[model samples]
Target: MELEEIFNEYILKSEQLIITKRSMNDIAQNEIKNLNQKKEKEQDITGNKNSTHSMDFFFIQDVKSGETTRYKNIRSTVDEKIKQIVLQKNKQYQWILSESFEIFREFLIKSYAYLGYKDKNIWPLKDYGSIILSEIENKDYSFFLEQTKTKRDVPESILNIFRNTFPEYKKLETCNKLDVNLNLEINLIEHFRHIIVHCGGKTDEKHKLIEKIIKKSGLWNNGKYDSKHYDFISSFFRLKESNDIILLEIESNNQDGFPNKYYDVLSDLMNSLNSVAYLIVNEIKTIVK
Candidate 1:
């Protein structure tokens, strides 16, 4: 397939997965309408100094006090930064989708082998180019949305939507490993996803926290997050017998008894950070909102 066809298909597939969450879908619509250039905008906070547009756009009300925000809007610099970050994230998201498609393609090719197809016809299943592009109804083409009937993907889209809507989240420090809490949280999320998808659905406390966050926020509620890798976490870190006692398991996943498998866990001591990331994020929102 042509390069344009490949890239376009990737964009289409990514958009489909992204549209599962209304929050993200809405942001995409609004942002696409507002911006022309993909590069970050040069923020002009002075233009909206009277808070006219800000007041109209964002609805932040203090439920108990019967009051809303006094300021019209947050800083304009923040808004532009948010747009920039979102653009960056969109580019990164494409890479991840393409890479994962490669893996999924290999699995499909293996299926052909079961039917006695030779490698000449199967050809390693490399070209996701045209197959992904052939489209039908917009609603019918959704991957997980069609698969899962009762739920939606919200939490998975939350961080992304937040980045798109909130400029502060977009202005993260890049390459500064020591101070990047969000980066660390992302790593934790990836590990959790991998474990759950690759291993059987088992979990310890950490895995449970991931599950709770996803459920509490009504994100990815189709039950895909409950992976088998959770079992590894529970088996190694969580106390199977004790109901009340909560403790962090060791850091290194290099324990002697752990079943020799493809994935491993933590670097040193599986130190419990003594908190839930989603909850912590919510608490901060509570104060600010």
Candidate 2:
């Protein structure tokens, strides 16, 4: 496929995923609201003190137990739904990063081919071209190319290609900004994505580092900070705060246990990812032209 087409498709897909997440969030919010209303009504009816008979008391107790079960079930269902949505969103985020890199790689290879630099032995150029060519003489080009797909290095490698080919092409302001933003945001997202995907959302050393930073900042004291106190930390982390402060609950331990606040974080990340993808595509178009 054409490089431009590939880039456009990635951006479109990212935007669609963001819309899906937003729709699901709205549904979840409404469901929670309805659930709370139902719970309140049940409590009012069951807790009425007008009934004095022993049988009425037993009946009311039974009704209260049923209401509690229903409430728990509703809450559990909503939580699971939100978790699934979050997992899907995370996958889309990773896909955008990987796919963007892939398109950039293809563009580099095509650009080199266009320049009549077709020594298939070095089909995809690398940082150390001469050394890679030497190794290829003994092994194979595929082996050398395969080694270049390191996650953290791919963006830099692609940028290097752009710099070498279009030496006179001044980097667009948007691209420069995107380069900086992606370096920071993608690294942070990738750290969490690694844990979420490989370790089944389990915390790891990266998370510990994050915790240490949060602790040193003194925003959290034994995970007992008021919900309002999340503003500074959220802004630092580039996370969005939910409109309702009541949604933020102080758990016994703040050890990243998939709180509702994370939904806001995921939402903000998705929006940013879509924006970056669009900017990158525009930048690529300008450079390629």
Whose lDDT is greatest here?
Answer: 2
Tens-place lDDT per residue, model 2, 159-277, is 44444544433243224544433333444454444444555443324335455434433445776654443343233233233211111212244477755544354545554555544
lDDT against true structure, model 2: 0.43
Q: Which stretches of candidate 2 lie over 4 Å from their true place?
A: 48-124, 127-152, 159-180, 204-208, 211-264
TM-score of 1: 0.21
What TM-score does each of the candidates earn? 0.21, 0.47
lDDT for position 187 in model 2: 41
**Candidate 1 lDDT, 1-289, residue by residue in tens:** 2223333454454345434333443565466455433322323534432222222245678989989875555544334555554544433333343333333222222222221111122222232223343431222313322222222342333334334434544444122223434334443444444544444223445556556544543333477754443343344334454322121223456667766332212211111111222222333243233
Cα lDDT of all candidates, in order?
0.36, 0.43
